[model samples]
Target: MLCFGIILRHILYQKKEAMFWYNFETHNFETHIGWGFLSAFYIASIFALQVI
Candidate 1:
């Protein structure tokens, strides 16, 4: 996706339509906290109990 965006901008710049390459910046930092970490820790704990 990053490569595609860069290529698109390059093409627009080559055509001297640099203004077309301009885009609004947006970012979303919301995410599920500990989604993977907790799952992995749970699995590892279970495995450790089995080994013991």
Candidate 2:
């Protein structure tokens, strides 16, 4: 389970930019919240979790 979680995280981290484009085209939830806050929260969460 832990290994799977780590792999999933690595995949997402590597695909951040590509996912943004996909989301943009799909008109996903971020269209409402905007990327700035999401990025800030993502960064803060990583820092808070001591992941970096």
Candidate 3:
């Protein structure tokens, strides 16, 4: 899972859309769809590991 996440992050980074963050100056959120999906995947994988 970790390896996959790393690879996925790398690809997303190369595409210039890896993670999302708040834009404090604009008082809005910046969208980075890839990170959202990646985060969900990581969370689910961690939960599954804990269950098993």
Candidate 4:
């Protein structure tokens, strides 16, 4: 998970220019909230799969 996070962060950093429109248009709070929701959903799905 730590390696995944590091890779994900690296990819995001590398793709910053590609996402300029999104970054420019969205407020920081909104971006953070979106990421938070995505992370929560990812974690929930992992747990759900484990249960199954």
- Per-model clash counts, in order, read 0, 0, 0, 0
Q: Assess the local accuracy of residue 51 in candidate 2 as a C-alpha lDDT between 0 and 100.
A: 58
Q: Tens-digit lDDT track for model 1 on 1-52?
A: 5555556546634543322232112221222223335445645755665566
TM-score of 3: 0.42
Worst 10 residues of 4 by lDDT: 12-21
- Choose the strongest candidate by lDDT: 2
Worst 10 residues of 1 by lDDT: 23-32
Q: Whole-model Cα lDDT per candidate?
A: 0.43, 0.65, 0.54, 0.60
What's model 4's lDDT at 24? Answer: 67
Where model 4 places Cα greater than 4 Å from the true spot, the runs are 1-27
Candidate 3 lDDT over 1-52, as tens digits, reads: 6666667656655544313324234433434454566667766765665566
Candidate 2 or 1, higher TM-score: 2
Worst 10 residues of 2 by lDDT: 43-52
Selected candidate, larger TM-score, 2 vs 4: 4
Candidate 2 stretches with Cα past 4 Å from truth are 1-15, 19-33
In model 3, the runs with Cα more than 4 Å from the true position are 1-31
* Quality of model 1 by C-alpha lDDT: 0.43
The 10-residue segment with the lowest total lDDT in model 3: 17-26
Instruction: Give candidate 2's whole-model lDDT.
Output: 0.65
